[model samples]
Target chain A: MIQIEQISKSYNAHAALKQASFKVDRGELFGLIGPDGAGKTTLIRILMTLLLPDSGKAHIGQWDVVKDYRKIRQHVGYMPGNFSLYRDLTVEENLRFFASVFGTNIKTHYHLIKPIYEQIEPFKNRRAEKLSGGMKQKLALSCSLIHRPELLLLDEPTTGVDAVSRQEFWQMLGTMKEHGITVLVSTPYMEEADLCDRVALIQNGEILEVASPKNIVDHFSSHLYRIKGKERLGLINALRSLSLFTKVYPFGEYIHCTSDEAVEPVVISQQLGQLGMDEIVIEAALPGIEDRFIELMA
Target chain B: MDSIIIDQLTKKFGSFTAVDKVSLRIQKGEIFGLLGANGAGKTTLIKILTGLSGASSGKATVAGFDIHRHVEKVKMNIGYMSQKFSLYEDLTVRENIQLFGGIYGVSSDYIKTKTTLVLDQLGLQDSAKKLVKSLPLGWRQKLAFSVAIFHEPKIVFLDEPTSGVDPITRRQFWEMIYAAASQGITVLVTTHYMDEASYCDRIAIMNAGKMEALGSPGELKAAYQVDHIEDVFIHIVR
Candidate 1:
């Protein structure tokens, strides 16, 4: 369980966090969704007691982040944005080192890391540097859990990883949540936002909206339409030139067009036909977190 | 016209075979995408094509030059931008562009005119005099891409050029790629983002040094009975 109140941090002229406030329920999987330089890392560092906030307060289960830094470090597990493992050491050695640093042994927390560790146990003797990106991340997660911390903080864990590996890593985090460990993960991928129980969309050092993924999508106050045509570029240009549409963006094979009020699909089709677009298909659609985030930012 | 041709291309490092008997062709001005998990041989294959690594067996030709006998010629006809952007952080944006232009043997007078055009196109004219480190990640990526193709190479290779960028910026970057492709510049890109594969004219999914699937995004999704490219990727890789 973590609580943050009116936290504000700045470095020289740039303010990284401004009156940012949020809370994570006990055993909840919370996500910080935003782009780089959006203060996700700064906030996480503040909670880890690695950086002091300029103002306000934060607590991790009754222990103040400032005064009880040592205790908080002992009770928290952090995996930074970049993989931070002893490259020269073997996988097993790195795990042991982290366990020893926390005043514990691997055996003491074997059950806690069994699910994640077992995946990489076969390569225990291999050096960390030789492992693949996915393997290295799994090793990092294993080391973080070697101490059986109550809270886990992951910063952009799946940023550069492949789709399958990203799915597996999220599945691992889901298991950790079931084990009663409070999880807070940050990511730039908007699709992953739905996986968290609740997410805080932060941008430019401010919290835009904090809600469940479904609730966030439900709050989108505009009607969305998915439009597909043979000429992708022409379709985009035509849709953007339309005066009725508020926003038009390319989404995979189709363009997602939004309007301030409900509009008939036939009206859009007629406009595209006049623009010489071919094979036009228009259908009503639901907006996702990414669309909602863009709307809020706008 | 074919920009690239390969026959049973294979690369081995020690006892490990990084690329195993791979064969594919990229048409002129086509946007080709490579999707694979880490260590799945995507990098090894790209290195071989770009003349950064040697192939242990088989034959390949890039831009009409045999990769085995004419590696330098292959390099001359191709441009590459890695995930890291390959820009000097300490150098100002204009200085970095000038450095790359000089390396590519472009005339100084032409570099001046091209530099201004590129900056204006990316809307980075205001930041042209600033150090690359001071610019945002998205701007740096766009600049890196522009520099990679500054020499007007026949083919451009981009390796995860949109990694870590915001969604909006990533879309804008793709528009740049589209603009280049329309100008008859062939593109061979590798990315981990499955959603991006849809934008490519055609894509190949590699697994364990083997080409597992190859088709347009719609065709691949149809083959796998999925609605999205992400599902197609998961279905193939899993």
Candidate 2:
């Protein structure tokens, strides 16, 4: 249960957030998806009361962000994008310190973060700085949840961690949600846009679109075809020159081309063959979240 | 030509070996990506090549200069943007450029032209006088990148330059990298994002202080028979 209304923030001339508004339902794994400088962090800061907004208001349940910062801080687990843990402190020490700050002991909420803590428990004596990026992430998440807050706010928590660790971190977040803790995570990866229950695509501090990942891609009004040929560069050049294609993005070994009008696979293969292409495979395909984001951005 | 060459490179910090026998080659005019989870020795390897840290027992040459010797020449020939936005937060955008330029012994006249060029490229011409703390994260990241390579070093080392920027900004940042490569500037970048590794000309994946795989993204993906770099990485590291 979070509500943000018309939040605006700016740093000198660069506008970070321009009256952005959104809401997160209780127990929802909500995602604030955007590129950098999209005001996702600013919103998180405003909600956490770490930074005050120039205008607008935000609330966590009944308390306001600006007026009840202390109360909100106690109730919201926050993992900042930056490495905020004391570099010199050991993993266990940092967890204990954060737990004490929230007037709770690590053991009191140890089970809440056991899945993550177990990964770093062996290195409990290791300093925060000495741990790997993935270890630091787990330690940070563990500390943040030591108080068993009602909400969790993670700002690109997996940005610099490995893919497997990123997956593990999301799994931990899901466990938190099982306990009825509302989780709000922000990420820059377009493919990660679907991990949450719902995502709000943001850009330049404005909400572009908010919908389920599948819904977003399904709503795309263009027909897409996955095509590939022996002459990669030549095929790419020829396909771009064709006016029928709306978008031609190279996806691994194949080219995902979106067309203004639905065309037969034979037509695509014939055109590529005419471009002196051989072994060309053309088939109708589904668009991904990143594809949908590109289309939205376009 | 290979802009960088590493032969059985290894770096140890006391009892812990940070980069263990890592060897790789990066070609000129190519955008080479380094992939690793955190603490996988990506940054340590970069530091060793940059001469920021001495390799424990390895031979490496960057831009044709040996890492063990010619440290100053290595620093002069390479422009580095660290993972953190290491710009002076208290200084104005232009002042940061001026300070860095002065440290590098750039002429006042060249600094003036370069500052304007970089600011305009980052769409921050109007905010040149604004303090670094007053800039948005995305703008600041672009500016940091511009500042790192302002002197036009032969090869640029970017350590997770797009950690937090949104997808659109990341795309735009890649365009800038392409532009740099077009000018024959070799790029050595480290990132955790697998998708980003796909966009690179060649990518080397590392795990547990050793290189897991290295090749053009296409080749690696094809060899692993995967649709994305993420799956390829999973196949190798697992």
Candidate 3:
């Protein structure tokens, strides 16, 4: 379990955090969701003992992040967004390196990372930098989990990798959650929010919203519908041109339009039908977390 | 002007070809998204255009300068932010800005004025004096971006600059990018975020060292006849 109380941090005159507070229950895949400067990393760093908080405090289980920095590092596995393992070392070597860092041997926790580690076992002799992105990702994961820490702090672990690799990496995290590692992840992907147990949306050093992904969408203050039509760009233009819509964003094959008033589907049909747009299909749908966050920010 | 032109550009490391013979033209003032899976060669292609790495037996030009012949010119005309934060943690946030501006040959007076503008734009004017080490990751990322484009490069290469950043900040970062594009800066960014791909005027999907598809978000969707870019990728790769 993690308890954070009124944590605020500032470097020079800019405030990266402004008394932001949240807590994560044990076994929770708590997501710190925010934009570029929301202080997610600052908070993570403070909790990991990588940086000192200017004020406020956080407790990792019973250990204080500041007063007991050394102890907390033992219980947490942190995979920074860009921190790769030793590039010059082989896969086996990297695994050994990390295991030693936690005062354990790779054989001791080999079972924990076996499912992922096996994928790169053949390349065990290859240097880490020589492995594929997905392979490297797996290797990084194996290293972090080798010690079997109670808490896992991953900072944007899937930034530049391929989509499928990103998917696979998250799936691995999902499996890790079973061990109840008290996972805390920070990501800019709104789509990834659903994967978390609960997410706190942060912006400009402030918390905008915190709720389950579904709850966040349910809290959306507007009616949502997905509209598909011929000449999609023209249709988006037409819809955006409308004065009655609250938001008209292009979503995949259709444009998800939000309404201030419950506009009749038939009214849309009639209007587009008159414009020679009979191919239009409108479906009432739920708003996603990204949409809600955009709405909130707007 | 077609700001970027790559003809049969390929990059190989020993027996491994990171980027295949890829050719494409990116229009001026367009927000183009480079998308792919891990090890799909997006980063390698970016390196080639920026002249960070040499292409293997192919021609690549960025902003009308030959990548091989005019490497310095290429660097001068582009702002590049790697996937990593790439900021020296030892420097202060303001000092980092000044350092990058100096690298880009920004005049002292211009650096002062432009630094003020960028810091204000990113809402980091308050942390201008904070050491980069003490800054949060998200703030460090934004400051890194401002540093990359200090000289107002014609094209800015953002290699997942928003990675690990919060969703709200990601949106804000995109707004800043959108604003830059609106000002006629050609933006070529690489990201795995599918939603971010949707914001691009056009997108190029790469897989295993080859360009799988390239077009506007809607066009690629229509061509693949898929509902989402996620699905479109499935259709393409499958």
Candidate 4:
């Protein structure tokens, strides 16, 4: 439903987005996955018509982002990374205000946000500022959906949220997807990439890769290994010093070591095993979206 | 050898108990991870330990100073960095370093030397004069961390310091934490990134204002019969 063509934006000397281009199918859940300052926000703002692009063009559905800004704003729902609800107003008041701004009432589109709104309904009387981080986000999402916009844009909604809450937020997005809403979301978390139908990995104002999560992993050509040892830092240093591994970084319970050429697991085991380290385990592993992103950036 | 000790610490707001008699001990040169959901009293507990707020009951000592009786002393012994508040966006990179150094009561000469050291270490010597707002989020976060520990405090508390940062910068930030802990600095960190729990020497999962689980990452996983710390966290909080 959205199309971007060579969109470029810059702040003085720094380029926030450079020749960025992507497309989102109607009723599809598309993710713009990148770290902070990776131009995810800038791209979203350009599509939302809040910021003018320095060059190129973008369209939200049938309307051009620049020529039809008014129409785009009316049909697009945006939840900024920073919560933009009326902090001094109560939760109920914020929802009502957003609905009124769109020339509608809460009851007109109550079903659109029912799944998320009901979670924070008991705290309807609480001030927006007084709610917890998770609750505030839910409230923000509810307000964004109050008018039943066809397109939803969320910028890093789960960036700082805990695991369980992040999961719940994504589930809400899933419900929106099932409702045939075109959702364009951005996040710095790579694990969440799997939740999207397709994700474009952007970094340093560049769109490095775009594909389904499974396809991105399938494109990983290097031999990756999962190595675990008793000492974390020591093992990383040892692997880095070997010069044989293309990449080595800590990944949860183990260190992910990648090499262009396939190497035997026994070789790594024997090398670190001589360093007086105990309980060394090494196994060939599959690359995740994060590992692929690092490789693309490298 | 303990850098922090807590005995049934409780923080109550009216009839609500944000921290319900929570107890924990962190050793010198250890990387301790604090894992919890939002409003799980992690921030409240940190505030009490850092002397920003008072505890309703319980006893706690940070860096050998009692939090209740020697709040000022406790403040001097610890450093804190959170995602929401860290550095002045309007100030230059070097000025922020010097400003924090002055706040910690360091001498002008030491501040001058450390400022250069920090800029060089972070490879921001060219951007030292640039306002902190001009830097990328990753670079800004690294500078904030360096400034937080500029005074050489005995303990450092990081509350989701890498929340919105990328995977690569997040790892580099952890490298700095590893370096600091090796230098005899105690690090108490909270992160929403569950993979990070494995990086800590020990982790404590708090739920409903209480310490629900505390152990090494491996131990917690084994106890909960899960392969990942995220699973352990869900098992406790969910």
Best by DockQ: 4
Tens-digit lDDT track for model 2 on A1-298?
9998888899887788999888899999988888776788988988999899999988999999999998998799999999989999999899999988988898887778888899899999998999877788889888888899999999989776788878777878878767899999998877887788888889888887888888888878789988866554466668887776887766544667898789898887777668677788889999888777777877
Off by over 4 Å in 4: A125-127, B107-113
Q: How many Å off is the CA of A49 in candidate 2?
A: 4.4
Query: What do the candidate models score in CA lDDT, each in turn?
Result: 0.90, 0.84, 0.82, 0.90
Each prediction's DockQ? 0.59, 0.34, 0.25, 0.63
How do all the candidates rank in terms of TM-score, highest first? 1, 4, 2, 3
* Tens digit per residue, CA lDDT, model 1, A1-298: 8999999999998899999999999899999999888899999999999999999999999999999999999999999988899999999999999999999999997988898889999999999999988899999999988888899999899989889889999999999866799999999888899899999999889999999999999999999999877666667888999887998887776788889899899988887778777578899998899789878987
Of candidates 4 and 2, the better by DockQ: 4
The predicted structure with the larger DockQ, 1 or 3, is 1
For residues B1-238, what per-residue lDDT tens digits would candidate 4 score against the true structure? 9999999999999999999999889999999999898888888999998999999999999999998789999988899898889999999998899888988999999998888899899999999899999888999899889988999999999988887787788788887887888889999998767877788889999998999999999899999999778899988888
Model 2 alpha-carbon drift over 4 Å, by segment: A9-15, A49-57, A62-74, A83-109, A125-130, A223-259, A263-285, B68-76, B83-153, B234-238
How high is each candidate's TM-score? Answer: 0.95, 0.81, 0.72, 0.93
Report the CAPRI category for model 1: medium
Pairs with steric clashes in candidate 1:
none
Count backbone overlaps in model 3. 13
Q: What is the lDDT for A225 in model 4?
A: 97
What's the CA RMSD for each of the models? 2.0, 4.4, 6.0, 2.3
Number of the candidate with higher DockQ, 1 or 2 = 1
